[model samples]
Target: MSRLPDAPPPGAILEAAVYVSDLDAAEAFYGELLGLPRLMRVPGRHVFYRVGATILLVFDPEGTTVPTSDPAIPVPPHGARGEGHVCFAATDAEITAIRARLAAAGVEAEADFRWPNGARSLYVRDPSGNSVEFAERALWG
Candidate 1:
């Protein structure tokens, strides 16, 4: 089947979201451990972090599944029940530093290896059981 006609050209991802059960744990794991700058947070609802030019959104499933009273930013109610995944781009040296940081934090890499393209990836889980990945840009190149 041919691609849909008249589809407007899309830009790079501005943000990606993953639902968590606990906001506090997610905050510590992402903000503290990963060293990503905290953008904003609404306690018990969601937390946002800056990852390069994009944003990483950690949301509490229960809190987001319900409609908000405010109409200013009427983001539609949406949530996922189970695990979600997000990948962060990293360089070789950055991957090494990340490995050391994870070891210091006692977090094991669920999967760490080089892809067929020779790009390395390190995978781990947050307290919310979401699959987090870090890989070099060459992995997709």
Candidate 2:
């Protein structure tokens, strides 16, 4: 039914974007907590961070002129709960420390998930109520 490339190597994931209510606060949380390097910033509008081989973009929802409703599509209200979140991979040791750090910083986290692929993860929220996850893959060992 479909053609496929023969023996094609897997390509690296480049980037993902998440819209946020406050650009500055998102920048602070990710930059400080996850230790991601800030790659770029657009005044009052957007911030991009380097996460491993991927780029994570945080855009200000209020600053964007995109319409909330249209005949073809509908957008969620700003800061809607359970919409989406970003996940960052870490080492097992780092994962434990990060959870403690987030707790001390007053960030709430869901119970950790230990997957069959030897990966463990925990979910937490940022200042804007968007969820975030920290994961560690045992395969790295």
Candidate 3:
């Protein structure tokens, strides 16, 4: 056995989730356009994307409300449905390539600018209307 704290650490975000009504569109935009690797997919239900060590889970709100197992799993119902935002750390090359890829896919950026800290960001919406951002932190000196 190991001796680690049972409580979660102060600043660790292990995973994030966004509820989407359509899985196909989500997969196409996140997996194909954003190039996030698809970790797994439950047909007509959910899709998981690996963003570095963080897992991005996109689930169909209508289908995901059901309990995980017959015993109910003692988990709260997440049945959330709406637009959410997620940002990924990107390199300068990735920022450029993402812009090109979005253009190729006919997806326009809602906003693009550099923050006061010299971080650059581009915001775009996935097919389900969730805002996705690709950011490069202080990449240009």
Candidate that scores best on lDDT: 1
Model 3: colliding residue pairs = none
What digit string (tens of lDDT, one per residue) describes model 3 on residues 76-127? 5576768998888888688889888898899998998888887889999888
* lDDT (tens digit, per residue) of candidate 2 on 24-91: 78887988876789998977667889887789978776654555556666654442223467778787
Instruction: Give the TM-scores of the predictions, in the order they appear.
Output: 0.93, 0.72, 0.84
What's the CA error at residue 30 for candidate 2, in Å? 0.8
> What is the model-wide C-alpha lDDT for candidate 2?
0.76
Model 1: per-residue Cα lDDT at residue 78: 89
| lDDT-better candidate, 2 vs 3 | 3
lDDT of 1 by residue, 1-141 (tens): 988778767879999999999898899899999999999999878999999999999999998888988999898998888999999999989988998898899888999899999999999999989999999999999
Stretches > 4 Å off in candidate 1: 1-5
RMSD of each: 2.1, 6.4, 4.9
Candidate order by decreasing lDDT: 1, 3, 2
